[model samples]
Target chain A: MKGLVIVIGRDLRLALRQSADAWLAVLFFVLTATLFPFGVGPEAATLRQIAPGVIWVVALLAVLLSLERLFLADFEDGSLEQLLLSPLPLEVAVLGKVAAHWLTTGLPLIAAAPLLALLFHMEPAGLLTLLLAMLLGTPVLSLIGAVGAALTLGARRGGVLIPLLVLPLYIPPLIFGVGATESALSGLSARPDLLLLGALLLVMLLVAPLAAAAALRQALE
Target chain B: MHRFANPARFTRIADRVLPFVAVATAAALGVGFYMALFVAPPDYQQGESVRIMYVHVPSAWMAMFIYVAIAVASAVALIWRHPLADLAAKASSPIGAGFAFLTLVTGSLWGRPMWGTWWEWDGRLTSMLILFFLYLGHMALMHAFDDQQRGYRAAAILALVGVINIPIIKFSVDWWATLHQPASVFRLDGPTIHPSMLWPLLITAVGFKLYYVTVVLLRIKSELIAARLRALDLARLKAS
Candidate 1:
């Protein structure tokens, strides 16, 4: 428990010191969301209709952009090897790193989501659901992305490969996340979608850390 | 299971089995296609288009079956460190991918005549597409790393993680198709198979399975030889 906290705190401090990394992801999210309106035409209804999908996808991509660096720095600096040797279980450390990653990257994306939603002229009723869905969804992204990052730790063409490996897994959360907001927008209950998103997050929480840790072990070996 | 762990023994067995499997594959496919194209009565609903099912259904089955096979081989490789299991998984993936690609194409061809569209985002089709992407990811991850061993282990873990998609693809139709039909996508329930149609479908499916077995045996044997050649070349380089 102590070790986990320490790892999280260490990552948090590192992220704070180099805050541009997190902000760049938020900027990318905002920038990409802005492009959709241009690509699809500037019509308000069109943007409003695509808002849920747009927000979810851009946020997902931003999270992916940050994931490649999650272990690379540690792996390159020898810190990952030391972490492997630590008293902390690598799975716990994985969870901690992923938690910190979510704090840095996923949180910013969620915080920036509603602004993009409003930009798309999304209804106020759906705005809260959008935030709620992202709150549940982005952590799953971080967790799953951690596995991809770990798997591709020393991989050639890691950047291109991570998205190919991770995006298919992202489909469920994408479906449910957009579903929740769209349901709320259509004046239906978002409860089922929210619950499914939560279920996916729980499953990934249990599964990702172990998979990431195993991949990390192999990469280091 | 470890009895077959030696690559030399496995290849010897594969060589002995290949000729018979290949012959059976050719015979079954010949008979199945003959029955399907010539003997089976045309569907009242789909007419000649129903013939595509003989290919599409079996390829879909093979697609799922090969993924499960890769997952099992990966588990063996990861758990027991069986020497040949990784090679088997690596060898099996492309064949699985080919079946997945074939399923999509035949499905598209069938869709064009019956649904009046070349594609639909129906649950089964969407899920099959995801399965295809999963196969691609597996194959790409297998070759992503510089260290061959690392690539094998990492891809093994990925295969195990991706096994979750198999059940999802299996059940996607039941779960998603009826829940909502998008305005753009068409949903059609499959027709019940008459025994006459059933015979050819089953025979074709068996033939497809035999083809997979024969091809995978050949692929694994070639992989073993390739590895041997690489080892010998490295040994020569070191001695020089």
Candidate 2:
């Protein structure tokens, strides 16, 4: 636990030093949301209706964009080797990395989501659901994306391959993520989708890190 | 399984079996097409358009069938580290993807005539589309790594993870109301299709299954030879 915390702190401190990375994610989130209005026309009614789905999609993508970089820098710098060799259980260290990743990318996106929501004229409930889904969904994304990143560590064109490899698995989350927000906007109960999202998160939280750790060991060897 | 896992053993056995498999495949395909195209009675509702099912349904069955093969092979590779299991996983992917592609094309054809559109967001079609994408992803991941062994291992893991999609695709039509026709071949009490059309559809499905087996075996043999050549090349380099 102590070692995991130290790694998390080290990762967070380094991430904060590069302000552009975080801001670029925000820029993408906003720009992607804005493009939809133009593509589908700027009519307020359409934006208002599609707002929840649109915001959820962009938020998911924004989270995905930064996820590859989770272990990438460390993997390159050889810190990942240290982490693997450390006394701390690889899974705990993995959880720490996922936590730090979500802190830098997912949390900020959750914070920025409501602003995007208002631009699209979303209901407060939908905004709430969007934030909620992001909170649960992004950690799983980080975890699952870690496995993808680890598996593709030495693969050529990993950048292109990661999303293709990961996105179909990403669908279950997207289904429930968008579904939850859509329900919230309509003032219907969204618990089923939310629960399913949580269930997926729980499962990935358990399984993905183990998978990631194994892949990481193989890549390093 | 381990005895056959040896590539030399596999090649010897497969080389002898290939000709017989090829002959049977050609014969079955001819008989199946004959039954489907010439002998089958027209559907009262779908008329001639129903003929699409003889092609589409079998490909759909093969699509799902091949993934299960992949999943089983991956399990064997991961648990037992069987070289042939790894080869089977690699060999099965393209055949499955082709079957999926056929399913989509024939489905779209059937949908256009029956539903007055090229496509619909029906449960069965959408889930199958996702399955197709999964196959593409698996194949891409398999070749992504510079190291052949690592790529194979990662791809095996991917195949196992992707087994989840198979059930989802199968049940999607049942779980949700879909514009695509409901299950006609395998059902609770009996098949929904009449006897005349049923015979052709069943025969075609067998033919497609035989075709899948033939292709997968050929692909695996080729991959084994390629791997052997690579090993020999590395050894030659070392000796020099």
Candidate 3:
């Protein structure tokens, strides 16, 4: 238990000390979101029409960009090897890492999202739904992305490969996230989509750690 | 089963079954197509356009069927650590993707006549398209690693998780209001399709299944041989 906490603490501290990375992830999110209005056009109505999807898509990309960093840094620096060798169960360690990853990458994106939602002229309801959806959804991304990250450990061109391996799996969350916000904006009940997103998060919370641990074992082997 | 879990043993078994399965698949395909094209009566409503249903529905059936097969094989590989099971799962992906592509193409072809548009965000069609993309992603992930075995294992877990999406795809139209046609052949009640059209659809579906079994077995055999050649090379390297 202490070991898992230490792992989480270590990840959090490392993220804190290396403030540049957090800033960069935030920058990536903002820059990407800013680009969406331009790509889709400056018309407020049009932006509002596509806001939910645009925010979700950019959020997905931001999460993807940071995910490889989750395990790659540890694995390359030999810390991951040491972590595996510890008496602590790898699954516990994985959960801690995932939590830390979500804190660093996922939470910031949610905080930054409301501002971007404003750019899209998204309704206040759309913004609230987006935040709720992101809160539930992005941790699932970190959890599942951990699997891809662990799998690609030590593989050639893994940086390129992780997104290819992980993005298809990302589809479900993108669906629920956009759906929740769109439903909210359209005055339909967002409850079903919110419930579905929660269900997805619950599933990832259970499944991803074990799967990621197994992949880590294989990668380290 | 454990004793025969060896790649060599798997190859031997696959070799013995390959010829028979191939022959059976060929016979089924021949008879199934004949029945579909020649024996099956024109639909009272759809007419010649109904022919697409023969190919489309069967391929759609295979797409979902093969994904479940892949998931099962993946579970076996992950749990029992069966060597050949991973190959079976990996080897089956491209074939499944092919079936998915066929489903999409034939669906689009059929759509043009019926819906009067090439594509729409209809529930059933959109979900099927997503399923197809998932297959493509699976195959891409398999080759993503230089260590092919590791990639296989990773992809196996992915294939297992992705199975959850299958039911969502299957029931999408029912769950949501979409422009796509509702289930006609498989429903709570008897098939809505006419008996004249029903027989060929079922026959073609079976034919496609047998065809899948045949091709997947062949792919597994090739994978086993490839593993053999890898082992021999490793042995030679050690000896040198």
Candidate 4:
């Protein structure tokens, strides 16, 4: 448990020290969201209707963009080998890294999502649900992306490969997240979508770390 | 299982089995297609366009079946360190992708005539689309690494992760409101399909499975021979 905290703390500290990576993702999120109105026309009703899907998709992409460096730095500098050699279970270490990723990239996306939603002329009723859905959904993105990142660590053209490998897996969260926000916008109950997002988070919490750790071991070996 | 892990023995068995599988595939498909197109009564509602079901449904079945097969092979490769299992998984992916592609194409053809559109974002069709992408990912990852063995291991992990989609694909129609119809063949009670239709469907499905076996065996053999060629080349380089 301590080791998990230490790993998370270390990753968090590193992320804070060189903050541009997180900023780049947030900037991408905002800029891409800004493009929707220009491309789709500035009609308020149109933007409002499309807002949930647009935010969720861009947020998913931003999370994907930040995932490349999740383990690449450690793998390159040989610290990943040390982590593997340590007494900490590799799965826990993986989980900690994923958690740190969520804190840095996913949190910023969640914080920025509503501002984009507001710009999209989204209704106030769906605002809270959008935030709640992003909170529950983005971690699932980080977790699944970690597996893709770890799997492609030493592979050729990993950047191009990560999206192909990760995007299909991203479908469930996007569906539920957008579903929650849209339901709330339409005055329907968002509880079912929210609960499904939560369930997805729990399932990924168990599966991703094991799969990522396995990929890491093989990559290192 | 371990005994068959020997590539030479596996090759010998595969060689013996290949001729039979190929012949059976041809015969079954010939008979099945004839029965499907000529003998079986047309659906009262769908009429002639429903004939596509014989190909579409069986390809869908093979698509899912081959993925499950790959997942099992991946597990064996990861857990038991079985080299043959790795080769098997690698060999099977493109064939699985082909089946998935066939399912989509045949489905689209059937859909255009019946559903009045080439596509819909219904649960079954959407999940099957996802399954196709999953196959593409697996095939892409299998060739991503410069180190072929590392690629195999990475792809094995991916295959395991992707097994989650199988159940979702299987039950998506039931879970979501969709334009696609519900399951007809496999049920707790019995198949809802008429025996005339069911017989041709099963035969074509069996033929598809056999065709997969024939191609995968040939692929694995070529891979083994290719590895041998690489080994010989390296040995020659060292001797020089």
Q: What does candidate 1's lDDT look like per residue over A1-221, in tens digits?
A: 99989999999999999999999999999998899977999999898898898998989989989999899999999999999998889999999999999999999888888789889999999999999999999999999999999999989998899999998888888888888898999999999889988988888899899999999999998
- What local lDDT score does residue B179 receive in model 3, on the 0 to 100 scale? 20
lDDT of 4 by residue, A1-221 (tens): 99999999999999999999999999999999999999999999999889999999999999999999999999999999999999999999999999999999999998888789889999999999999999999999999999999999989999899999999888888878888898899999999889988988998999999999999999999
Question: Which 10-residue window in model 2 chain B sums to the lowest lDDT?
Answer: B171-180
Q: Which 10 successive residues of model 1 chain B have the least lDDT summed? A: B168-177
Off by over 4 Å in 2: B165-190, B231-240
Worst 10 residues of 2 chain A by lDDT: A167-176
* Tens digit of per-residue lDDT, candidate 2, span A1-221: 78878979988898889878888888899999999988999888998988877877787788778867877898888889898888888888888888888788888888898888889887776777888988887787777788777788878898888888787677667667777787787778989778877987887887787777777777788
Question: What is the DockQ for all candidates, taken in turn?
Answer: 0.64, 0.44, 0.43, 0.63
* Candidates, ranked, DockQ: 1, 4, 2, 3
- Per-residue lDDT over B92-131 for candidate 2, one digit per residue giving the tens place of the 0 to 100 score: 9989999999999999999897877898766667777888
Candidate 4 lDDT tens digits, B1-240: 899988889889999999999999999999999999999999888899889999998898899899999999999999999999999999999999999999899878987877778985556666778889999999999999999999999999999999974564345333443212453321212567899899998899898888998999999999999999999999999999
Candidate with top lDDT is 4
lDDT of each: 0.90, 0.81, 0.82, 0.90
Provide the lowest-lDDT 10-residue window in model 4 chain B: B179-188
2 against 3, candidate with superior TM-score = 2
Candidates 1 and 4, the one with greater lDDT: 4
Per residue, candidate 1 scores C-alpha lDDT tens digits across B16-128 of 99999999999999999999999999988788988998999899999989999999999999999997899999999999999999999998999998778889777777778
